[model samples]
Target: MGGRAFSLNTPPIRHDVYLRLVSKFTTLLQTLHEIVRVAPHAPEKITHGDIDVLVASPLRTYTSEEPIALLGAEQCIPGFPTANFAIYEPEIEAYVQLDMRICPPEKIEWEIFYRSYGDLWNILGIMGKRVGISVNQAGVRVSVEHIEKKNKKAAMVHLTDDPRSAVEFFGCDWEKYERGFGTIQEMFDFCAGCRFLDVEISQRREKITVESRRLRDLRPLCQRWFDEYLPKLMGEEAGREIELNVHSREGVLEEALGKFDKRLDHDMLVGMWGKDLFDKEMWRRIRALLPLGTKRGNIVVRALAKRLEEADLGNGEYGALCESEEWRREREANWTEIAKAEWRVILAAVQ
Candidate 1:
């Protein structure tokens, strides 16, 4: 379940200074209305009491006369000083209603306009060093202050449509969305690679899972190493030195995870274990055979491996390979160590 934020009008006006200011605001509105003209047929309302203003709703605050659809807070800014009485478009209906009830019965000859609150922290329930202001009628502007919150741009991004809606949807806190999205993307990438390791027929699943997770979480240097540099290196004996190359990448792995890493980092763990493993040249040739711009590497490899794994073999004691308990154990242990070593190297390079 989510929680909603409190508005300044939430009873028990917490600050003494704010309470006093609000108390005087009502008187200020009365004085302004006395000097302004009253409209004929307008109700003769007293300007000495509290008036409710619509704070948030679907209607325009200044110009529209539509019936209120969604109810927000009832404002209490009575007697608030106005050089001239002006109502904003979306909020005009509610403002007019309250004015008719609380202001002098005489119509106040004045104009109506809108002004967006520049203090995003005050509206969005969070503080940031940078802030943005945009008006439906006006354009956009940004502000940065060292003593303010740092995620101001992010807050404005959320408020692209309606600042009020953004604040409400994200629980009146921009950092909540920021932190939530960060965790979501990280888990998404890590789990995607780890899902592949879960298919193994060996006891190396745990180690593979951890390494795959790390590779997915790579940052800065590590990202370049595993995605761009590692895939270009030839076999260990070929002595190909690894260096970042943005253009080099395997099509299959690159397709799914390319935007993240140039190629799938986990694939290298598999290639490192076997003598007959696909090398850089073999990978390139395979990629060339693929349709231009195709990136589905895992699907291609799995399809090939599935077909090959099902091949019929001549009846013989080939089962002897599995008969040796020592051989089975050795295969698992060796591959596990090799995977861990490759993962460590990748981690080191990234760090």
Candidate 2:
């Protein structure tokens, strides 16, 4: 609306083709926004009749089948969608798909392929890790090995297969191994530097944990509590009593319980407790022993804030990618209010 005009073309699109086209277009636009850090300005738009795509004027046109061509267009590009696995161009940072016929969500193989690519790259990028690549007649082979500490032993490990597999093997119970090379962050770092063995491998390895150690450690604690303590507390004696335990002194537990009660009060009044039913007394006691101000709360809040800030509020300003400098500036015009609102919601939950 600001500088671009949208146009629609009335052409008959098969139902299947239309769905694929719409999905691809969305991903393309999102990727561009992320890469350019600017909103996309479509001055000329073109779309066949009744299609979901909204193009701006000067009228750029391309078929839904031609994903590469669609992605390369200057004004319009695809962006991320809620449920599709696709690649992003390094230059524009926009999401792209080479084949709409291949539904990423439905095709488990394709999903596996894309996810694996993202995973491999992440694992090879740790601080002293070197991901070595060699080209052979068969295919490309990439490998990473490093010395890591486990139970007071420095052991060398090999991760020479697909990144997705490495992540699965190493990060499955990451808290147990992340003190060394077992983390999604290591996986992401590996992905950022290494090329995919195939397209499938890259997509599977999309997300990595940079500071995963904290969560990794906490994961075991939660698991142990759920598996061992829950039953013991219930007096049903399930698993064998292990030497490892969480500090559960009555005084500390009582203090934790008190804090939990305060937070629960805030949460219930603000409607944050709808997701789960927690015992007020138990939570207060747990809060006493647990680190109260960990960044876990902030992480959840920031994630929600970022999502809301980028969401379209139906202000008739659709098609503008917020990552663009221009769009961000415009958003910043009212961004503070939105941010404050999100902060309030998150703070209430974490309290």
Best by TM-score: 2
Candidate 1, residues 25-108, lDDT tens digits: the string is: 434434323332222110111221222221211122332222121112233223422211222223113221223222222212
Model 2 lDDT tens row, 290-350: 3335565346335544564356333333322322456544544444444456556756886
Model 1 misses residue 86 by how many Å? 16
Candidate 1 ranges beyond 4 A from true positions: 1-49, 52-126, 130-141, 144-165, 168-351
lDDT (0 to 1) per candidate: 0.28, 0.32
